[model samples]
Target: MNMLIFKRFSLTILILGTLVACKETNKNPQKKISETITSETQNDFLGNYVAKEYHQRTEGYDWISVAVRNKGDNTIGISVRSRADKKRPTCTFDSKAFKVNDSLYRACSNGVGILFSFKKDSLKILTEIPEQADALQFYCSGGGNFTGDYGRIEGELDSSQIDPTLFTKTLELQGIGFSVSSFARNNKKILQILPYGLEIDNSAITRTLEGSIADVEIEDLNSDGFPEILVYLSSDGSGSYGDVIGYSVNNGKSISAIYFPPISENDELKKGYMGHDEFSIIETTLAQRFPIYREGDTNANPTGGIRQIEYQLVDGEASRKFVIKNSTDFPEKN
Candidate 1:
């Protein structure tokens, strides 16, 4: 296995979805909190929040900004950024935060976990352990103090203050990890993926994306002891069509892609298929589900019920492909 000794300042790649994820080491096991939180209570935390010295702007003064969004199923994704300066004055923490209480959530980046405490229109961060506050200096200049306090911004965050990173995430399994990020450059949406801990060097993967990324999942689908990374993407606009990009570690040495044929190319599966698909790793199989569309149906509603298709990852003539294992249809519910 790769000799990755997590130290006082080890890198913990963090991933978040809804289009992007960033990297960071999760120093501790994920918090096992009650699953009884309501959607309304969670939605209260979604917004663009900003921090300014004296609650007012000063010439040539820098600032910190936080953006919060819901990742569906009661998950909250938070991003913290700051105006870059000459030195390593940049502070970045992007990850899905776990709810700790009605007014608090905790997120970790680079082995240092911090709590998000919300009160009224303002928000502040306190480290899970007081000593860890000193570690935050690793992300900034001169080993300074962590500075991220903000009042909810009424609208969007000022474009000039935040960096161009739109989405990022890192997913790991069996000691292998993939750091992913998406940004706009030269009018094109670019997707960059980098992998670490392979005996053979796996160069970073970069390509143009037709649609925005939705989520990324990792699993050893074939029980190979190695891991595979699955990236789900969704098209913009009403259709919200979904697709997957997969990479499998080659015998614990290298990486390769898994072929996923388009539904429009298949006669049996495309009979009543539209967009709006969902994908997940269910035990040993990759499962996809979507509302079945019949003739004269609008995008909003489909009366034809739902269709679920499960695929098993198997070797093809050369690389790998997800072969359909089972397909089922359920009638529309009342």
Candidate 2:
């Protein structure tokens, strides 16, 4: 009877141990399922997307490609490339994680902290620093066509309305300084006309003029049917006293004259005169044909002086009326 009791106790202990082991086995599977779901859901955003609206404001292109890839070990990586210029891929975002289309995305642990979300087809960029929001907008939209000229921006156009090939050609033409105007067609020549000097060049569009020019007056001065430009040259330390140089656009391009009052002229009327200095040009009305030159010393505390020179173009020649110098401001001729 004691032996039977011992056998029964042993059986009871075996049954309890089996039940506990079964419970533990069931819990392990549940934990595993949870981990699998997290991994699958978190990586749903790994893929490539194209920027739809971002192509409009940037370097004259229609689309930019954005890519998100999983970097193993719970991290993500992001990159961007332009459809127009593929050679220049801007930057990379590492360790980035965000939601896209109701899916979670994550980047590598050691990458840039850039995150992005999707609203339909557009990307909503997020960064660890709030100020980076503005920067991301710029990055996405800054792919417009660069004319490769003097930083002139070429606007992106609707693909349906304009041909991309033709648009690019137009931009290239403008870069070379060719344009259509009412005055001239296929105007391939460019000239630099300044008050102190004139530079005539077929490649004027490629060069940028550096110097202070004030008060530009464009007129049919010689009545040769072409516009003549008048400007004032003021003297800094680099050059001499201010003088007026006139250029005639007629007959291609030519310097008509450099105006400097005779030295024997009255001292009061020449108070602001620098033998050969620089000047600024102020634009008044078309009827006023006089050029006003601002004169002053090159040193600190330079004295203020104003000189007014009246000019008329008759038969392709510049005729000077009179010059008046004043310490005070010169009144605009009515």
Candidate 3:
């Protein structure tokens, strides 16, 4: 009887121990799977993102690129670059407990500051600092515009002084056909402009530029509440011909190409035909406008010649009566 009781007690203890061991074993796998899922979610957010912020007072647009990566310590590493300035600025923070709320994450260096927040899959940037009372209140929001590929940006220029019904247009040069190729305004419109012709079409919002657009600074020449388009056309891949074109948005929701001089001339200047290469517009004064073009030889050698054409707009039409040609050694001084 004593041996039977001892055996029964041993069996009961053994069963209880086995049950406890099995429970712990099952929990280990569950914990591992939960960790894996979390890791994957973090990686999905680790990539390049494009965001835009609008300045109302100055009527300027700020495009920003952000790179996020997991630091393996329950935190995320962030690197930021300005599309306007083209420099990298970096910051670090604990992302494990971070949440996008009414308040934003602020950072600054070298006279530059950025305030950002992440909401769902998109990021928002605050354009105004808290101290600036007269500053415009702008927020950058993204997502739902593309089919889960590239991001899209929409800029709302706060010109309370201007007509509220007036629309702002953003033009991006796509390529150079016999004329200039362009993808304008959130890739909604594609335009081709030649010496005396124009072609316009719609583009896929998710598509990217098939050809390289010459890197040039776009400026508002006429200050007519619109930004101009500057395109660089390359002759032989060596150098480029400068083509400067002005554009404005009409009430019909269509882009109207404002023909500036040199871009509209039927004849080339004394140096050569306007190559339609890369060019930019200079607004020296409210009354004066000049188109600066980069011209090179067929061998891509700098012919040492740059052309500056003066332009005027009267009654909503462009006039290009002044032509000034100069070499590198004798550029016309402003």
- Specify the highest-lDDT model's number: 1
Better of 1 and 2 by lDDT: 1
Predictions ranked by TM-score, top down? 1, 3, 2
Write down the TM-score for model 2: 0.26
Span of 10 residues, lowest total lDDT, candidate 2: 166-175
lDDT of 3 by residue, 1-334 (tens): 2333423433344334323323422322211212212213444455555543422224444344445554322234444333332222121111111212232233321112333444345554432233321121111122111101123233322223222111122223222112233444563434443321123432212222333343322334444543344443333243334443344333213344554444444344434433434232334211111223345444433333334344443224353222333322223222
User: Which segments of model 1 are wrong by more than 4 Å?
Assistant: 1-43, 52-58, 85-89, 96-149, 331-333
TM-score of each: 0.73, 0.26, 0.30
TM-score of 3: 0.30
lDDT for each residue of candidate 1 in 157-230, tens digit (9 for 90 to 100): 66654567767776667888888878899999998889998889779999899888877778899998999898
Clashes of 1: 16
The true-structure Cα RMSD of candidate 1 reads: 8.9
**lDDT minimum window of 10 residues, candidate 3:** 139-148
Best of the candidates, TM-score: 1
Worst 10 residues of 1 by lDDT: 1-10
Tens-place lDDT digits, model 2, residues 1-334: 2323433433344334323323422322211212222223435555555555444535555444455555322334444444434334333222224232243332211112333543332344434333333434433345342111111113332333221111000001111221111111143221242222223533322212223232233444444544555544333353334434444443443334434454336555455444443222222211211123355445332334223343344442454322333223343232
